[model samples]
Target: MVSGIPWLTVLWATPTVGAALVILLPAAQRVLAKWFALAVSLAVLAITAVLAVGFDPGGEQFQFVESHRWIPSFGTGYILGVDGIALAIVVLTAVLVPLLIIAGWNDADGQTGLRGRSVQTYLALTLAVEGMVIMSLVSLDILLFYVFFEAMLIPMYFLIGGFGGANRSKAAVKFLLYNLFGGLIMLAAVVGLYVVTAGSDAFDAGTFDFRAIVAAVASGEFVVNPAVMHLLFLGFMFAFAVKAPLWPFHRWLPDAAVEATPASAVLMMAVMDKVGTFGMLRYCLQLFPDSSLYFQPLVVTLAVIGIVYGAILAIGQTDVMRLIAYTSISHFGFIILGIFVMTSQGQSGSTLYMVNHGLSTAALFLIAGFLVSRRGTRLINAYGGVQKVAPVMAGTFLVAGLATLSLPGLAPFISEFLVLIGTFTRFPVLAVFASTALVLSAIYILWMYQRMMTGPVTDGNDRIRDLLPRELVVVAPLIALLLVLGVYPKPALDVINPAVDHTLTTIDQPDPVPRLAEGPTP
Candidate 1:
């Protein structure tokens, strides 16, 4: 294997490099701009596919690692890598970007200044955001990871404000302020982590490397006062919680989802939202194992509440997009539950959920965009008997809806089952409450599907057509993946299992010995 040039770097760079090429096109050439963006995204997709194919499932350490010291004195390095967990997400982002580009081809930005010129900006910003998010996911160095984490906000901020629907400006501002506050809090914690590790020659002037921090903490060599560790942990947790957007921190999501363009919403909910849970997995659990163990109960409690609360609100929604957004909130709760349970199965299941959820949710959002573009409304009541006019579109919606509800033999079913089974070992009561969410999900997804695709045809929609060839091109891969992974999940599970073992081992916690039935402890 190449010593320093990690394959994951290539995955991260493919998009950025593609964005640069797209930006070189003349600003006025809208068609060229659109095609070039498509070409670039396609190229990135190819690279990520290679990464996925070449990734070794047997190894326990990060694959395709590229590491070099960038700031020698401060001990910061430009390090990048991905294990099974990171690989899953990196690929998911890759899979969704091209579909998003196609979804935006109609340019539903309402009022337009540059006509299709906005497409160029949208393409470039999306590529940039994808690169940054992948970097954050794979970066082994703490400071480098933080830089990637914060950089993503800039592109998303502009995308929301410039191309979003009515009240976009306000939604954009709220999104920025919420993230900025959480990021500032995280920065302070990083400083605290540095101060605690200062004087170790291993890090020179205290390195901001994530692996280093974990090593120091686990070995008990880098001594931060217990109270100090607790404080720093909370700071990190707050930032991630805001990102995972658990419960009270979730208000920004609905408004943002409602106001942003559908493409932007896909990126935000599918890719960006993963960052929150990613933080908890990459930083919080690794850096503060004790604190994580300490906070398990409370975290699980909140997650359960979110699962129930978000599901209730989703069923009650009249707006289809808003309903989808609430579904995500409930999904996030399940993911959080898996994380805090500290089981290998739970962790791996959450990681897999991150990947599958992105694909399924992107399909739902893009398909929703198609319907709205043709019909000019997102209201559930505004649609009916659309399947007669648009059989293919209705079928795609059914697949996505079933995927969302985690129906048996679907991709989501495997992951959700794993999460509940694994979490139930530790917190049976919480697991039961969370399990009821599956029934709730069926309610909302099928209800929405029925409202839109069943019943007598409406006057205006009678002439509406099925998914165009172009729309099929955008949605086909997502539908196939749901089936492929659902039928044979061993490929993904192989990549995930090794890294999950490493994560559990590194945390130095007891292996989660799952109890199949209630009985005396063995």
Candidate 2:
């Protein structure tokens, strides 16, 4: 049921309005623009907290639901709602953007010859991206979700091309071309889906209403030829896979991550990437259960390949930024594997992993970005013994690194454990292969740490200063979350499990019953 408050519109529109206002601010008020943008992000965060508190996991599948006539000819509406799955990422997006704004405080200060006008543009673009992402998460109309899903690429493209390293333009174009190609394929699939609905006797007209179609699909009311369904599924999967970047399609990520500012990279990897994995759970499995089951083996194979492949490539990277980028690819592999495995634990753990990964990766990547900014380099071999001068920075880096490797007491460990166990119940050999990433992760992380932070203080490295107060503010909450969620993920899990269970029910996949080893009679 829709809430009385129209909270869904307010949740996304706040930042949209803020972005417009920030852009309208006079050029001289750049500092004011920055603070205003940050304020908007924080307000959005507060809104998410209210939604969380008001969200009753067991009450209804969608909360804060709202629908209105939009493009009546197309049978689409301005619809929005959130189940636990969507809410998890909405909250994740909200929590991360404020810190990202803080982390990127000086990233667009016209440092690389930005004519003093780039600051407001940078901040406004970030807010615009935030608003569009939230809209994509809550949207119940498929076309609306697709519009924002594709629209966000605009702000992000500017963020990548307008700021950061020399190769920024090249990376931005590559990122756009790859995703646009995928989106184009999905466009065909989306239209095909509408056409199928129009031809069906179940609807008054063709509609892009996601919930309506999901309901009809579930009741076996909306039927399409199996071959056509598979093609449609492939179209959607291709787009999401490119975004999720499962293996071979992931070449664009490393460049984009390296070229984009640290905060933007984090926003892309930690937040935007979650949406891809999210599409798989929400749309792929729900809308095309038979097709999903049929294609499970192929996807699981690619996921395992990506897991090991990303880790191996990361171990060989000489660039610190590139190394971290590769790690995200590996992490995304685990997320996809969990999703396709279809166990309740797998899906729940995947959801939690999305959130934990955002925190841990953000903490690590931002710290690394801080180091790179000071030294004016991203090469790993460029420095040694950083800990001698920047102990706090190195210490925080260590914790984030350990979390990345899924250290026993860190937040990622529990989620990783659940995913593996869940996958093992269904696909043991694939689980074993995927598990190899644990050792690979430890190697890359520890080796990088030893070279960059632990050895004797090299000549230039001794000049490296510690994290500033603002930087500490950025890292502290992420580290604290990693520790807190590591020790106790119940809060996150509680919100995620019901939603996961419902998805499993929708797909008709049951958790494998445990078969204990027989013991000798005592």
Candidate 3:
């Protein structure tokens, strides 16, 4: 049943209104714009909390739907709804938005060359991106989904191109070119899906409804030969892959993450990239189950390669932020690995990983940003004895870093364990290779930690202060989550499991693949 609360609309409006407020704030009230953005993000978080509580795990359908006829002649409607999978992603976005603003605190382009005049524009763009991401997460219709999916690229492109590091424009262009190419291919497929269903009328059917298409295809009412179906699936895969960016497709991620503002990097890696894995779970797996199953090995191979490749690269990085970026690539590998493994534990773990990874990555980037802000560089060798000079900062980094390595009590540990356990049942050899990444992760994380936080004080680092109250506020919740979820993940998992089960059911898969209790041997 559709939720009566108009929750999705509320979600969209909160950020939309916030963005408007940011734009309209008086020039002298630059501080007001930042507060307004934070307030809006907080409001969105409240709604997400409500969603988490109110969402019916057992409903077996999308909830909080808000549908309207946007274009009658085309059979298209402004349809929005959230199922289990989308719910998790939505909550992830809501959770990250506030943290993003916290990270963006007092951050204007002035240091990067932005005069105060541009602050409102930056905040507004951030809010706009939040709205688009929420829309994309809840959109139930194919065309609407595509619109929001592609729309997100805009605000983010500006955030990077305008406010990013020295190579900002180049990074933005690379991001756009890669995504546009994939999006165009997906667009053709979307059109093809429409044509495949139009049935000789040769006229536009005007409907791009996801359920309608799924039902029609499944019931054999709208037949596309298996070959054509596979082709269409590839289009969707290409778009999502470039976004999830498995292996060779990931060239944009490191550069983009490095060049973008720290907050932008967090949003892109923590929230946006998850959309790719998300699309695979919801649309790719649900809309084309056979293709997903058939292509599992090939996709898994890419994921495994990314896992090792990203970890290996991260180990070699001296740039702090770049190292973090590569870490994300490695983590995405784990997410996709569980997804294609096709076990309930794997799928659920992948979904949970998205949420936890977002929290951890956001924390790390924000803290790194603080360090760079104080020190004027992210180079690992720029300063030594940081822990001596800035114990609070080092402590925050330690917590966030431990979380990244999947320390026993943190959120990532559970999810990574789930993925490995789940995937081992389906793909043992690949699981073995993927498992080795954990060791590599330890090497890079600890080695970097030692290099940056354990040495004697240097003259360049003498002025470094520990985290201030505002910076601590930015990190506190993330630290709390690390302990909370690590100790008892049930609250999040309760909601996540049902949604995951729903997606699995939609794709017609059975729960939790069985295997020997023995874990993979490295």
Candidate 4:
């Protein structure tokens, strides 16, 4: 089914082209601009679907790869490819963007105080973000990946600062500064890697091509001093940790999520933050295996702390948006824990969690947004017995919330269970500690649901309307995918396992040997 077509190029270019078209539209053609953006997103989704069908789940190497020398002098190139992991993420990005477009269509119509020009600007920026995110997923060149990675901030900054709530500017600035600081650190690491490569016998100059870098490392031609290597690892780790917003570094997330519009928050949480974990796997482990192994205990300990800390903080939140943000911090901890555990099941589970979290969190955020739009407030106390007025909306919110808590028979449950099982095989104590978050998760989600959707209808809740047709369209696919993946996750796991195995093979690491009880026979 594989075709010779430049699918990756088309996939990356479509949304950017759409953004240009929307921007070129006449000032008065706001509606046309929105529709055009939606059309472009849909097209990208279609292309992604085609990619999935043609993708070989058993393939051990990157597929649909396209490469060209962009900067021969520096050994940088324009490279794009996807393995099962990247393919899954690319599809997730495609699926969410169109739904986001639909969910935010009316909101973007300038009804919420954003004018026509502002609306157009919002849609264009959103499309641009979409394109960059996809580009990041498919890029096989570290330099190209970093370009897409850093470039994404511009449009997203505007998405928040220009189109977000009252303190949008301040939140946007904080988000920018935090990420920029991380990016600068990553830049230093990138330069250090290049220096190591150039000094090696593999080449006279360093190369930014991922394959070349991996080959050079594998041949033992590019060797970094152990001390320098550990520092480089920390440099990359700090950047991704901030981006993943792991615990102590996670301060920026709540503020940004609280201030950004719902759709923007979805993009940030669902797809963008994944880049951090994805980079940890793709770059950290692949390029610096010794450091990754050395740092495993520290990373695992932090992840466990994040799991408990995030869940406890989530239970204490009054702002619904901030609560969801905190929950993501907890969820990300699980993803990271699975990744660092290094078992095939754990790695695949982490990868699957990325997709499942994207779906589940999108539903939660968008459904919450629907409620906020109706009641004109983001406070949980402002809502009461909403089910009495809007049963469907209440039900959708419950389902999304349950998904977040990793309720059994839901998408998240499958991934979460695998992560625990995989981790328990090696680090049973850490697994047990991480499992306590399940109870805390239930308290946070159900408590929030009880406070917001149960009890008597509040004074203003009587006027609250049910989910409109457009709103349902936005959530229906997410819910359906969640259920489908929950029941039949084999398709995703099948695609993911090969890549996970390949990653472990590349790193030349095996699962930790389990300790067993001594027999009484002796």
Candidate 5:
């Protein structure tokens, strides 16, 4: 019903344009820029909220779609839409940016982060990343998606290199290099797709239309050599895996997360990295169902390894921020595992986990940043008995930590439960192994809290103040969201289940039915 509105364009363009407008603000108008940026983000959030309320989960698979001719001769058009999966994430992107701006209100002005700039640059970059992420999520044209997908790295690189810790430059370089290599591979895959379509009876000429390609793929009209398809699948998967930074490709993350300012790290971990996994769900599986099935085992194995490896290393981290970063690797492992398991519960749970991880991680990382800023250190040993001084911050930190470990009453718990349950139905053995992360996560989170928050005051940790009014503004909503979603995931699941059902229909993966034992003969 919202079809005529071009809402998707406005949703993304609001922030993209807002960033430019923000950049235009004079240096003397720093506070005005901050408020303006926040207002723009909130307006974007308002648009997403309207979309959510108007969205009919029972209706069209891709809602509020907008398509216009753009380079039509090249078989590419400007197109945008959202399935329940994409909408959920779009809303997530919208929700987090405003909070991040509030959390980062002082980052540019502080002694920390990059030197010599008004707050405008930091805020603008944040808005720019938000806009680009939304564009990537909503684009129905693969090449359009690819353009903004890579475009995101530019603003993000500046945020990290300019606004992070002492090693920001090195960390940002590593971050860019790893993702650039991944993008190069994905670009080849995108070109290969156009070539394959062009040569097929499926089209008059090469097309970059994602829906057209998906239709052809699902209908078996888009047949190609198994080897070629496999190569193409790997090409796309390689980029996503690296972006997801699964296991081996993950070396760039901890350093980047630790070096970047806390808010930027949250945006990177919480929002942007999701585009990778999102592509795996939308493109990899649906576009190459056969190849996805072919490589499912290997991918699942790697995901499981990432789960355990990340947890083990998280347990060993000496730096608090680095520990949080490692925990994300572990959480992302679960997300990837769920996606590859190819079960409705698994994919749905994985989708929900992305949102939950954003909320929980934002809370944890931002609160930690507040503490570090006060105490002037990121080392775990440098903090002790923080709870004795700043009880509110400590309490919120514990809640965020528990959510990270997927404790029973928090948001991540339900997602983790669904993912494991989904996996167990098909691959019980792998599920059993992956479950070990639960214990390891508990060890890392609780131990970290025990060491840093619970002991007697030391290392001048007593000087640590409680979360300020502004910090409270950032942490409160996240904690509430974790609680609300944890208890009533049914609302999200309602929107998500239909989409999951549709994806499974496209890829032809039905959930496995459990066999009941025969009743004893009477």
Candidate 6:
């Protein structure tokens, strides 16, 4: 009833239906497959835009909700809805996918591997992954969310292994194994959560509905031993942290990023990786607020380490893709820090950062793909003075690089600033430490740009062409969004802040008072 339009169903079903259509297409009709995939993605994007217009930012409850019984005995249902947070991410997913389809239109065509099935296979898997991602974002039932969360890996696995670099198989296996292990651990927590919910007085026995669980927890009808609860919390937290691919747990990302095609990397870094951080906000804090507070120090410490370590590693990278991957680790560190700080500004900033990072990172990956396709290499020193031969590509790459560094007039700067300010209000010393990443971020981005785009034109670079019309089409929207979001972020903030406030209310936590500086002798 929130939107009275069954918007969530349409959003999820569009991609699923599209994927089925792509699979049914004639095997030889690769062109038809690409067009059909793009059309499907565009349809989803249009639906998401409509949903955004109808969304009531002031409302604190889930909107566009649809629920039907799927397993009555287990108290689970086919439920879907979106709060402000989910709404933003769902839209981001919708937007990026069409662009990804356009960017990869010819990437898999005539590729030697895969027995010439790369085009149809790539399109089908992409649509399938889109459906799974949207489902994960909107699912209101814990069981349903878990299903979508785990199922997402299947298509991504194929995308990485089937259509990537020489080492694609190895990267795909590493990615699957890491996520599979995380999912298995979370399965234990899911079962334990179900048991705990069944015992709660506030819920029907065997309920797997997230809202029901939240109600039980809030009302104190669901109780467990503190030690048991901490274990449950850790189980969920570990899965999310690994997904967030937080430090120490982040080893697989560089390999996967280096091996994946540019479009696939966008899906991994910009969309799929977001699932982890989003899970932390949705599951960890909401379901286990006490444990969240208990472990705040530990999580914050890891975040600080990720910020510094990721930036340092990025600076040392020789491969362009690997460097971009390392930068995301640093950016994600800020996101985790903001979430654990538990301030309104921090949470909102973190959410906004998710959207901003997706755009900026997509630009970087896609533009870098253009460069690699031209020079046929991913090494930083492969070619130089590229700006001389390909001015447009150089400009686009520089803008993306600047955006990654969160330049003052770019989209990410606002969110990064908010995270630091919010963190300072709660943990001044930690804020000071986290802020050091800012300088490190600048060094890595500028260093990469200088090495890759500056200096005299190298031998192979002389033949490199500027971005074609199709390539321009691929990156223009993202660049435009970065500029628009940078200047006028209020619309997004308005939608995000209320949802963050509602989340805090659910956990009965208030924003900490900012520590004010005192005047001398006042």
Candidate 3 residues 344-451, lDDT tens each? 899889998998999889888889889998999989988689999899899889889999999999989999999999888878899999999999999998898898
C-alpha RMSD in Å of predicted model 3 compared with the true structure: 3.4
C-alpha local distance difference test of each model: 0.85, 0.92, 0.85, 0.89, 0.93, 0.90
Candidate 6 C-alpha lDDT tens digits along 227-248: 8789899989888888888887
Instruction: Give per-candidate clash totals.
Output: 1, 0, 3, 0, 0, 0
TM-score, every prediction? 0.95, 0.98, 0.94, 0.97, 0.98, 0.98
lDDT of 2 by residue, 432-453 (tens): 9999999999999999999999
Better of 1 and 3 by lDDT: 3
Question: Which candidate tops lDDT?
Answer: 5
Residue 422's lDDT in candidate 6: 83
lDDT of 4 by residue, 376-484 (tens): 8999999999999999999989999999999998899999999998899878999999999999999999999999999999999999999999999998999999889
Q: Write the per-residue lDDT of candidate 1 for residues 228-339, one digit (tens) a residue.
A: 8788889988888887789878988988888888988999999988988988987889899888888889999999999999999999999999999999999898888888
User: After best superposition, candidate 6 residue 14: deviation in angstroms?
Assistant: 1.0
Per-residue error (Å), model 6, residue 131? 0.6
Clashes of 2: 0
lDDT of 3 at 502: 65
> Which candidate, 3 or 5, has the higher lDDT?
5
| TM accuracy, model 6 | 0.98
Per residue, candidate 5 scores C-alpha lDDT tens digits across 318-386 of 999999999999999999999999999999999999999999999999999999999998999888899
